[model samples]
Each structure stands twice: as C-alpha cells, then as structure tokens.
Target: DLSEILSLHDFEAVARHTMNRRGWNYYSSGADDEITMRENNTAYQRIWFRPRILRDVTKVDFSTEILGHKSSMPVYITATALGKLGHPEGEVVLTRAAHEHGIIQMIPTLASCGFDEMVDAAAPGQVQFLQLYVNADKSRTKKIIEHAGKRGVKALFITVDAPQLGRREKDMRTKFEGNASSHQTKGGDKVQRDAGAARAISSFIDPSLSWKDIPFLKECAGDMKIILKGVQSWEDAVLAAERGCDGVVLSNHGGRQLDTAPAGITILPEVVAALNQRGLLVPPGKPRFEIMVDGGVRRATDVLKAVALGATAVGVGRPFLYSMSTYGFEGVCHMLQILKDEFEMNMRLIGAPTLTDVVPSMVDISALKVPTVGNTMFGVNYETMYPAGV
Candidate 1:
C-alpha cells in the first residue's frame, strides 16, 4: 500500500480512508474556521525557488544538527498528543521510527503513554526533546523537568502559547458525545463529555505561565537546552533569547491554536531580522540562537524554504502520523525515507550541497504576503494534485 504513496498527500488520503472517524477529525481539524490551517500549506505556494545549476552537487547531503545532535535531515517529529488515538503502539512507534531515521522526536506531555514509557522505549543515545505544558502545580512541573534531565532529554521546548486551548470545531464535533474519556477522568475527576479530546486532557495547562518561570524551568532542566515552542511574532522571538532561552520555535501549534495567526513561514524573515538587529540572533560569545518553524510543511521544498529564510530546522507532525496510522512503524519509516530522498534531490536541484548552503537567496518571498481564500472543505480530505510529468 505504501508503494502507492508517492507523496505526503497520499499518506493523508490513505489514513483518512482507514483511521477512525473520531481520531481523524481530532487530528485533521484546526481552530475556528481553520483559515490559518489552510494558509499554512498555501503560503509555501507563494514562494518559488531560484535553483542554481552547474555546481558540484553530486553528493547532496541532508544531514543537519539540532542543539548539537546529528539529524539526518532538517526535520524532526514535532510533538502531537494522544498517539493511542491513532495506533495501538502509541507514541513509542514514533520513538522507534525517529531513531531508525536518525532524527529527533519531541515527546508531548499529553501523550497516551506515560513520559517514562516513551523515554524508556528509546534506543540508547537517541535524541529526544520534551514539549511541556506548564501545570498549575509548580512542584509537579519542577519534578517533571527534573526527571526529564535525569532521563537525558536533549532539550525542553516549553510551550508559550495556548493560555487557553483553541476551540477546534472538528474535534469538538466528535466531543466523545455522551461518553467520558476514561483517560482524562482518572481519580474520580468529573467527566467532561462535551469537551473534545484536547480540552478533556489538557484542562490543566497553566494560563499564567509567564516569562518569570523561564529561570525556574532552566534551573530545573539543569543542562538541557530550554526553547520556547509557540512563538509567532518577532518581538516574542527576540524576548525568548533575551530571557535566557536557547531558541524559539515559530509555530502556531499546527494551526490548532489561534486561527488566522500568521503561518510560521511567512513570519520567519521578520523574526530573523529582529533577532539579528538586536545582535541576539547569535550574540557574541553566546550559544547560537536557533529559530525553528513548523506547520504547513509538506514537501522537502517547504523545509528548504524555511532553511533559506533562517530556520535551523522544521518540525513535521501530521504527515508522519498519517503514515503511521496508515502503515504502522514501517509506514513511518517509509515516510521519513521519502523525506530524506526529497531533501537530497531538492538540495541538488536548488544547488545546495548541504543545509548551510540553503541560504536566504535560494527563495523569493515577494509573493508570500499575497493571499487568497483556501477551500475549507479540503481539510477533511486531501485533494491529490498532479504535475505535468505525472
């Protein structure tokens, strides 16, 4: 079946046809009206590549480093919650797949499997990052970070956005209807049948998680790199660096939060400029601040575009889930291999032998600001497109 999957869209199509209705809607839906979700993907269409030729690109290497760890490509498995919704093996399937592909996986706080289970399942020395949702209980939060350090997570990507989880209508529509999610209602907590999967599980994310807590988190994390994960504006991006964090991921939570927030790619230029202007981008004698982008990334072309604009790497979640939900661990590995192949071929086509060569000049963002209405109906299903050669 994977042989029939030539593109990421194919994975989505197959997954949609195979995955449970509740899980599909929860995974595919975005925030209200889903404008930002569609725009995330469409934004890439606005930028065209200015490929170079006649260079010694015979060996287009895609290997890149994240927080000093080697990654086979400028791609990592961004954290997504409740992996059991899609597969029996849960998030550990992703853990194994990430190791096999030599990429990083950001473990989520809301994963179906306990944090230790995911961590314990990792192959030795496999790099994993933890995405945290600060709990109202400060002591518990401290303990979580401390345990992450002891377990050897490479980084802590503390989520700074989502003071309140967005109203994901598609996920809400399923709403467990009349049934309470047993997972979220442990210890005799009140059943919340009306709340969607996210709200049911994530009701405890501290809305008061301010910059003041960054120091506490850093101290708790010990030597682990502390990166803020939901930064959107250039000001916040700069503030994260000045606040003593190592980096910021310019993500809008895969368009799951804050509908109509600018897609992460469209804002990468300004974030870079803002940080560079402050001399904070890579301040003298300080660790080089990394900027990462996620959301609306489908093609390796999209990944290279972000790299060209200034992102050190990009986080991809849904497509990998789609592949996993459709084809299991093998499917996830195949999807990564597909990306690896795309990175190599696209790099040569664009005349970049390596990620560092994927500079700002390789892409034209002049059309990036231009926008048009995207079809919302397409969210539930992927409409496969064909090129002239196809």
Candidate 2:
C-alpha cells in the first residue's frame, strides 16, 4: 500500500475513504463557507517558478535549521490537534517519524496523548516544539508552559487567531446526526455537551488573549523562545517583533478560523517587507526573529516558493496527518521520504544547490493577489460533499 502512494494528494484521497466520516470532516472542514480553505491551496497556482539551468548538479543539500534547531529540510511538521482521531498511536507516531527523518514536530496542546507521554516517545536528542493554546485559567496555562520548558521543548508557538473556534458545518452536521464524541476531563468526567471536536475541545482556551499577554507568556515560558502562530497581517507581524517574540507564523490557522482570511503565502511578501522595513529580519546565520508560513502546502515546490519569498521555513500540517491516518508510522515515514526526494530533484532543477540559493529571484509571484472571490482548485473540494440530502 505504501508503494502505491505517490503524491501528498494521494494520501488525502485514501484517508477520506478509510477514515470515519466524523474524523475526516474534523480534519478537512474549514470555517463558514470554506472559501479560505479552498483558496489556501489554489493561491499557489498564481505563483510560478523561474528556474535556472546550466548549473553544476553534481550534488545538492536540503538540510537547514529551524528556530535554532537543525533540520533535514526547509519544512517542519506543523501542529495539528487530536492525532488519536486519525491513528491509535496519536502524536507519538509523529514524534517517532520526525526523529527518524531528522526534522522537527510541533506538538499540539490538545494532542490526544499527554505532553509528557509524547516527549517520552521521542528518541533521545530529537528536537520538538510545543504549540500552546492558552487556558482561561492563567495559573493552569503558566504551569503548562513551565512544564513544556522543563520537558525540553525548543520553542512555544502561542496560537493567536482562535479566541474562539470557527463553525465547521460538516462537523456540526455530524454532531446533529448524534455521532460526535463528547469532550472529557482528565478524571473521565464529561466537561460539556458535544458540538463537534473543535468547539468542544477548545472551550477552555482564553478569549481575552492580547498583545499585553505576550510578556506574561514569555515570563511564564522562562528561557524558551516565544513565537506567535496565527498572525495574518503586516501590522501584527511588526508588533510581534516589537514585543520581542523570536518569530511569527503568518497563518490563518490553516484557513480554518476565518473564512475570508488571505492565504499565508500570499501575505508573506508584505509581512517580510514590513519586518525588513522595521529592521527586524534576522541577519544571515543568526538565531534571531524569523518569519514562517503555513496553510495549503502540499508539495516540495510549495516549500521552495515560500523560501523564495523570504520565509525562514514552511510548516506542513494536513498531508502528514493524512499519511498517518492511512498507513500509520510507515505512511508518515514514506511521506517524508517523498518530500525529501522532491526537494532534492526540485533543488537541482531550480539551480539552487543550497538553501541560501533559493532566494526571491527564483520565483515569479507577480500575479498573486488577495482573492476577492473563492477560487476552488486542487485538494479537498468541499462543493461535492453535500448533494441535496434533504
């Protein structure tokens, strides 16, 4: 079965058929009309590569560092919640696979497996980061952050977009069918009625999170690096740098939170320009503030395009989860291998032998504009899902 899979899209197609409808919808559905979700992937179509030829293609290296940690490529496994919904082993599968591949994994706060357990599953010296969903209870949030620091998490990615979870209609419909599972507390007590996974699980997240809270989170996190994960504008990116965050992920929470938000890649140029204008771009070979992007990255070329636009690196979420859902740890391993292969070939073709060679000049993004209307193309077409079922 692993041999049969070729592209990241293939994993998604197989996962759709193999996973339960509840789980698949939870992973795939975006907010409101799902326009932003579709745009996240299709936005890549507007950017084209300006590859070079006649370069020495004897060897190429894809290895790079992320947030002061070395990685085998210019991508990391971005945070995704409730991995147990996809596989029995949950986030541990990611921990193991990331270790094997020499990359980093951003462990989610709402992981099915507890934080310590997931850390325990990682191989010794394996680098990992923690994605924090700040709790309404400040003391509880502080304890969790301090715990992650003690547990050797390399960084803290505080999610800033989701003050509240978005309404994913598919998951809501699944709940209305009485098939959704209830959220439970650590003592096996039911916390609330099920309203699909996102809302039910995210009820504990603090709604009043703001810029003023950054210093408090930094203080709570001790010496670990602090980065905001859901920023969508140049203004916030500048403020994040001003607030002394180590990095900012220009994301719309995978287009799952706001339906009309710009794709992460589309806004990256402006964010980079703003940061540069403020003298915030990190000088080469320094471990300072970085800019990262995520959302609708399905290929090595997508990663390459982001790097060309001044992103330190790219974050990939859904494709790896789909791989895990389809074939467990082996599938994850295979998926990473596929990406590694693609990066090598693409790098050779693009005439960028090193990560530094993949610069702004390598891609043409002149046609990239903020979408005024939803344009549906490649990956997870939501239109075909409902067909007059009433």
Candidate 3:
C-alpha cells in the first residue's frame, strides 16, 4: 500500500490516522499560534522559477556534499527529538533509512536509543552528524562531543535556537488532557507540572549558552566540523563564521522554538549576501563555509529552490517522521525514493542538469520584494484543525 503513496503529504495523512493521538499532536503541532510554521512552507510560493530552456538535460545528478560528505541529493535528515513516540523502533529507523538512501542523518542529542546504539547501527563509512543540545554540565557535554568524534561523527551541529522549549499548545493540551491522578488534590501544593513532552524531556538544556562557549565546544569537538544550527539572522551567521565555526544553519528551530520567526529560506539570500560582504563566505583554500537552511521544506522543488539560493543543502524532518511512523523502514525508504524521482524529473524540467546549473538566476525573487509579513501570513483563509466536539 505504501508503494501507492506518491507524496510526503500522503505519508502524513496516513500518520495522522494511524499514529496515537498524543504522537500525532506532538509531531504535527507548532509553537504558539503556528503562524511561523505555516509561513515556513507558504513563503516558498512567493519565489517563482525562471527555468531556462535548451540545456543538455539527459542525465540529472542531484548528488552533492554536505560539509564535504557526499549525499545523494542536497538534502539531509534534520534532527527531530523523541522518535519512539511515533515509531516503536525510534530514531534507529531513520538511521537505517538514511543508509539505504545514501543521505546524511543528523543524530539528535536526545534520542530514545542510546548514542552508541545509533552510531553502531550505521553501515561502515556512513557519515553521521551530531545535533547537540549543550547540557548544563560542561563535562557531560564535552564527553559527548569527544565520544562522537571517536565514533566518526563528521560534524557537530550545535543547536543554538531553543534555549527553552516553546509553547506547543496542541501538544500540551493533549499531553495534559485527562488521566490526572486525584492524589495531587490532597497534596499541599507539591504537584509537578506537565508542560508537554517537549519540556519534560529537555529540562537540562543550558540557557546560558553564549558566544563565549564556542571555543570550548571547538576544543571538545576535536576534528568534527562545528556548525551552529538555528541561526536566524545574517548577524549570527556572520558571527559564527568569524568565530571559527565551519558553517551555520539559518533556521528558527522549524518554527517550534520561536513563533513568527521568518522562514529559513526567505532569509538565505540575505545570509549569503552578508557572509560574502564580510569576505567570510569561504576563506582561501579552506573548505567552503557551508550555509544550510531548514524549515517548511515539503517538496523536492522546495529543496531545489533552497539549492538555487546558496544553501549547500536543506534539512527535512517531519515528512520522514510521518513516513517512518506510518510504515516503518519501507515507508521511509519509499518516501526518499519519491524525493529521488522528483529531484531528477524537476531538475530536467527546470533545465538544470546538475546542481551547478541551479544558480541564483533560476529563481525569480521579485515577489520577495514585499515585506516579509506579506510573504508570510498564509492568511485567515488558512485552515486549522480542531478537536472533535470543539
């Protein structure tokens, strides 16, 4: 039946019906009113393609390197927490799927499976990256970084956006709905609060993580390319490069950390422009200071749009989760195959035989001339889901 699933949304539709209510809400809900979440995808609509004609498009190669690691396409599996919530096998399902597809996977700091377990699951020479949530305890964080280096984690994508978990009310409401033990009513105000799985699982994150800690992290990370993920503005992107970070991911934590944050794709041009302005886009004879983006990427066309704008690659998270949750390994593999098919077909239609041909001119950003508010706000016409009997 999964073979009949044509798009990522099909997988999502299946996930909504089959996964538990808690898992479904947790996986799909965004922070606050979810404006930024919707904006993340819709913003892509503003940029139309200026596809060129008459190019030798016989063979299309979407393969590219991320921080020098070869990937089948300019796409990598971005880290998402609590995989077991949706699938019985948890994050390892994604690990195996990435292997089958030959794409890179960023292992999350908080995975249901042990760190070594996922790393051990990898095929020989399969490159993995670590998405670290710096613990309050520096020694523990250092140990994780060092261990990852020894395990051959090629990069450290230190998440810088979520100092504290955001309010994903849909997840919280369902998380807190019912099943309350009445014993708490007898207590003299010693009851613990349930702020949903997001806060419960992420309590140890150090809010004091500042620019000063980069050098310490670099020292701990050893040879792993240190990339600061969740960079929102051009300023932070520039700072990361200047401070010796190998690259930066312009993200808003997939609109889960900060509501109303601009989609990463919309900001990619400015980030690239600023990085080039400061002469830090790529230093002489050094590995290119990779600028990646994630958030609101749904289609392979969205991936190409990001590629066209200066992103070395794009990170996709939810679609893979939906696939994995619905049908496990085969589901994830099939979803990836769909992307692979789209990449080749779209590449040809757009007259891009290779990623090099996916230059900036291929996209017409004139629609982006309006203010970001206009670009976002998918409008009151934007439909929203509600609980039954609401």
Candidate 4:
C-alpha cells in the first residue's frame, strides 16, 4: 500500500532518496551554521508541557480565528513554491486536500499552476490565502494582488522575509534547478521555462521599496486583509500594524532568508509580547494585529506551543512538502489530519479544551534569555526593544 509505503517517518527517509540531492538540501538548509534552525527545535524541546488530568475533553474544539477568518484549525499549510514538482497535479491536488481536511493553505506566488485554477479545484471559498513576494516589477506585484482580489482570495499574505534570497549552501553545491525570481505564484509575469527543466534566475528584491511603499500596497490590496509574512522583530510588527496591515506572520522565512537570524519560534515571544504591550506605540483603536509564526514546527504539540506563545496561527512547511512528495494529495490530507488530530489530542491532554484556554504563560520561556524592555537589559526603552517601535 502506497499509504503504508510512506508514513510520516518514511516521508523523511524517502525524501532523502527521491529528491534531487541538492534540492532536498536547499529546502532543508538553514543559514550560515544552521544554529538558529537547530535552536528552533531545541528551544521547544526545553519547554515541558504540564498536562492536567480528568478534564472534560470529550468535546475538543480546535477552531480559531486568524485575521477574523475562522479556521477549523489554527495550524495551516505554509506557502511553498513549485508544487508541480512535488506531484503531477501539484497545487490542485494540495488545495483539494486542504479543503477536504478543513485546514488553511497559504498558496505561494511562485506556484507552478495559476491561482484561479487552484481556487476552482479546492472547495469554493476555502480558507486559502495567497502569499505574495513583491517582484522587482511593481506593476507585477499590483497586478497579482488585484487578480487575487477578483478571484475571491480571502487574504493577502505579503512575504517580506525574502527581500533577498539567503545563500542556500545545499542548492549552491548541487546547482539546484529553479529560478527564485519566477517562482512567485500570485504575480502576472509568466514563468518562461525550457520544457521540463527549471529556469535559472536572480534575486527579485526591489531595493527601491521604502516604508512609504506600504501605503501604496495598502491601497492596491484594498479590501483584502493584509498579512506581513516575514516580520521577526517587534518594531517591524508595530510598523506593519501602524501601516494598516491586518497581521504580521512572525517568521524567519523558514530559516531560508538569513543564515544567522533567530528562528521563528525563538523570536516568537519578543514579537508577541511587544505587540500585546499597551502603549502609545500603536494606534488607539487599532485591534491588536494578528501574530502568526512558522519555522521548524515538526509536530502537533509544536503547533500548540506556538499558539500558547501568543501566535494566533502557525504554519507548517517541510512536513506538508514531505507528504506531497511521498503520497500526493492523499498523503498531504493524511499528514494534515495527523497534525490536527495530534493537536486536539495534546490540547486535551494539556487540559486546554479550547484554543482560548492556552495563554502566554502556558509555556515557561523564562529559562531562555528572551530580552524584555521594562527590565532594561540595555538603556533602550521598551519600545526600542522592537525594531519598529511597538
């Protein structure tokens, strides 16, 4: 049975064999020494969950709201490029799987297939958000956002972490085939290719983009809720909120952006705590911006840990890719099921019947030296602890 052929564990084992060695390395590679990527998992390992016994957990509810949209589960699929390479049907199959499972999928701008096609394949109005990587061409970026809006896409997830691609040593060594520039899924530019092979390309970062460019993006996005996907600092989080962005996805581009930066989970608290702090920093009536994080999240309990750490939502990247590569849509659906099931099971075991029951103190991060401003580790003000004055 193919299903039995590739259990979640088997996916990892098989992935090492089936993928282009360099490609696998690129997807798995962390920046510089990969210390942060290692830390993303180790930090979580350090936290021990204290499960409460004899709680009424027969009726477990895992549903939660992200940017006001109800998700059956707080965990969602991370935006990944080139679904076509993963399976014959690609995003079409993945979207159907996500729809079937009542989970969210973040469709990348660089998806091999068109967004409208994926939208039609999935359940109508499924909770799939479009992730945008603003291309070097501003017009291309605007056109993509406008198209997504017309297609009834629920949210606009702007990926700001990858302004410049990180030096992926694995891909570099193997000469992995693909163009980062054309990989984006939402934009209008057609990804020209030579038949079956991936194309070679260069960096897509628009160095010209300034803080002022955000208002233009806000105007372009119009009614589509905006989520900045690569925010790791409190300052950037606050900036996103002040600039009218509805949410900030606290991520380090899945450890794919910079090699030396902190892992998403490692930096989750700083972003969440800063955003939650009451101050003149944010607009008075501005509903606190959503904090969603992803990177090195390997288990359902990891999702629970992130939610407890103040993340409204958490993204799963490589795990879904592993499923897709190993068993196609059926595998992807099954993997999501396992994660959601595990999440609910763990939530009950931990005595948190509902998502709201999980709070900041759910996991003690004090052992970790997470810098706080009120304490003044430095002379910097509390707001300065964040990069953008939260």
Quantify all predictions' global Cα lDDT against the true fold: 0.84, 0.83, 0.84, 0.70
Candidate 3, residues 1-390: lDDT per residue as tens digits? 987799988998899899988778878989999999998899899888888899999999999999998999999999987778788788899999999999999988767666788899999999999999887778878878898899999999999999988989988866433222211122232223475666556657689999999999999988889999999888999999999999999888878878988888878877777787678887888888999999888789999988888899999989988998999999999999999999999999999999999988788775653644565433211012111211
Off-target runs (Cα >4 Å) in candidate 4 are 1-10, 176-202, 279-286, 370-390
Error of 3 at 92 (Å): 0.8
Candidate 4 deviation (Cα RMSD): 5.0
What is candidate 2's local distance difference test score? 0.83
Least well predicted 10-residue stretch by lDDT in candidate 2: 378-387
Positional deviation of residue 114's Cα in model 1 after best superposition, in angstroms: 1.2
Q: How accurate is candidate 1 locally (lDDT)?
A: 0.84
How large is the C-alpha RMSD of every model relative to the true structure? 6.8, 8.0, 8.6, 5.0
* Ranking, TM-score, top scorer first: 1, 2, 3, 4
TM-score of each candidate? Answer: 0.92, 0.91, 0.91, 0.85
Candidate closer to the true structure by TM-score (higher is better), 3 or 4: 3
Q: Which ten residues in a row have the lowest lDDT in candidate 3?
A: 380-389
Give model 2's TM-score versus the native structure.
Answer: 0.91
Ranking by lDDT: 1, 3, 2, 4
Mind sharing the TM-score for model 1? 0.92
Backbone N/Cα/C clashes per model: 0, 0, 0, 9
Q: What is candidate 4's local distance difference test score?
A: 0.70
Candidate 4 lDDT over 174-240, as tens digits, reads 5435543333432444433332222223245565666778888888888888888888777888788
